[model samples]
Target: MSSQPVPCKNLHEWLSFLEGLHTSEIDLGLDRVLTVFRDMNIGKIAGCVILVAGTNGKGTTIAAMEALLQSAGKSTGCYLSPHIHFFNERVRIDGRNMSDETWVEAFERVESHRGQVSLTYFEFTTLAALFIIARQMPDFALLEVGLGGRLDAVNIVEPDVSVITSVGLDHQDWLGEDRESIGFEKAGIMRPGGVCVYGEVNPTKSILQQASAQNVDLRVFGRDFGVLDADSEPATETMTDSPVFLAQNSAQQPIPDAPVPVSYQMADGDFVRTVLSEQSIPVSNRLCAIQALALTGVRLDKIDIDHCLSLISVPGRFEVDKNNPKYIYDVAHNVHAAEYLSRLLQATRQRRRGKIVCLFSALKDKDSKGIVSLLDKTVDSWAGWPMQVDRALSLAQLTAVLGDNATNAECLPTLGEAVVRAENIACDRNDTIMVLGSFYAVAEVQSFLTNRANRSRGVDEKGIEV
Candidate 1:
């Protein structure tokens, strides 16, 4: 294959080249990436590295961890996938997206080193992110796994702590059919003799088996550590046999239903209590990130923890627009994430004076029916639009799925039209408009809203006055 001229003009050209470089969108393996990574001699990114893998909550957990570490005066480099707006959002240094020039430089390095080996968009970007982060030599490097843990390109880098946020059946085509099979795929991030934190309440049997076989210092959420309210009993002593105990009682005790100011017990029989202000960010994910980071020898006082956590504002995760007609945006593509969004809606139903109008769409591969059925009761009206992407569901497909559960549905052409239709429906009832489905769905709506807001303020797309 002829090496075409490198797209050194800007980040956009480089990204476009990467999208069409490989035959398939997702080629999940490490051999090709590792070959290029080793050639680049990128070693020991930071003093501590954390690899986060799961069906959901990876982005939010990493965000929380980065914020906490940065709050403690430690420089952090975080690499996340599927940016909502700018490609720069994928690679962040010191909680800020690196400049476009920096990203172009990283991409150039990867292109120069990769001779004939074909790398997918994710693989090439992952390598570039590692290169950029290693050059900065931050105190901590947080890598969010793009796909399944075991064979993902990011897995090529060994992590000090591997965290599995929550395992569910989302990418059945790549990961597996059931939760156990998917759990096994996620468990691939755990290195032997290394520390790992399992954050969800339901610890799958496969995860237990993998942790035991690898002799990993695995920390289960409820068994090894957990959160408790002020009125609850004292922190339970760290269990001796964590995997075995967890296997037997995984479902017995769940995350506390209580509110903030909760005390989180660590694996070493220590407790840290702090009040969390971000209701959108789950308490379990916050505690999981804190516990995982503590194992890396980074500790924060209660006040610092509270301060950092309060500053975390992840986009598209229950992001609210508190204008005249309120709106909530969540990138809940699969059933697992949909469950979380459903619970939040149910809890806040009492405060909503008007109808809950959900503007929703999803990829063709997703379980659109399951998500629609699950959220049917909470959402009084539905507006579906075909997300402008290769894998998105068409208007007919979306309407067909909504037929099963959604009684008041509006099938529209684009996200803007869908939002307008939803607003018209909610205008009479003072309802809230929620944009749900894949990341692409949220991106479209957010871009539209942002541009509209800017136009209303007499500002152009470049942020210049009109």
Candidate 2:
């Protein structure tokens, strides 16, 4: 531990300093973080705290909840993990990224009171986010767990409500190798007598056991609250074809599309019709967010829900490049997400006569083989691009899994080259190019496209002309 005052004067310098504080990138546990939390005396940070955990849908569910709460005239503070572009994206105050000065101030406070308690990169940043949120004192504080809920740094805060979006087989090394074990880890956020809104149709035995042990009010999807199939119908609205990601202004915000209405049966057996932003969101996640917010007494009228959902956009999930409808990007690295993406591709293929080409890469720890195999039937071809990160899967590993399907797969040295190859393959064929795999892969492609768009607009990354 460094006894000298932190040598950082800015957010960038402090981020670098925090990265070296611990040898490992992830050290999941609450004791070390809790000590700092108490030392900092950040008690009662918000009027209501919601802890959300899951394998795939955590970010989407939390984003939905934040949007809904804010629509109801409640202040919201959100903390998300594994940001796409910048560290500032990890912490949002009132639907906007906090300034670099805000981050520097929060880090200084955490460093001063840390008192030799070494924290990992995630722990340090999480503390800084909580400190900032505490100072602002938002009405609703939404915390997304970085990993398994049981020992994650965010678990140090007691939550009024917990949300388990879906339990899947990601991060098996720490959480466990099976769905049952993974469900138990996710169930850690539940408190006795508190409400937990589960999003999936079927609940794993471990989750049920945990909730029963804690005597928690677990409202499950397809049971206590779910989509009212009789009244629910697909919306006929279509999004305007425009570039969703722009490098200029550093705000890749997607424009608001027409609201799609969804009907759901609430816990009281009463049906409510809610309008969500777009059809890209899975109905299950939207239902879970509404149910969780309902437990907190956030009753929103139809118009309010529409307004909020229209303004909400979770990037890197079913993000289509409007300039070329053929180019799509999604951060689907695991089996569950891949299956959903595959179904989407199959549906799109049915509507259009064209081939589906997937540009893919994944982390060494992810189930890349499973994802590729799951989408193999729906995707006519594959373009493998190794992410630039150390944990990214090597070209050989990606090819080894392609195995018998190697004839249909093409490997490239970099993401940019791989994308060029993909575009060439899909050129003039009316085929779709879907970018899938880990977050890093999607972020790289998004950056490439955004830069290309900025250049075409005669503006640099800062929106200044050359």
Model 2 worst lDDT window (10 residues): 243-252
Q: What's the TM-score of each model vs. the native? A: 0.91, 0.88
lDDT of each residue in 232-287, candidate 2, tens digit only:
44432222221111111101123234544444444454556545554566666777
lDDT of 1 at 230: 44
- Expressed as tens digits, the lDDT of each residue in 96-135 for candidate 1 is 8989999889888888889899999999999999999999
Q: Whole-model Cα lDDT per candidate? A: 0.82, 0.80
Q: Provide the global lDDT of candidate 1 against the true structure.
A: 0.82
Candidate that scores best on lDDT: 1
**lDDT value, residue 190 of candidate 1:** 96
lDDT of 2 at 284: 69
Residue 235 CA error for candidate 2 (Å)? 16
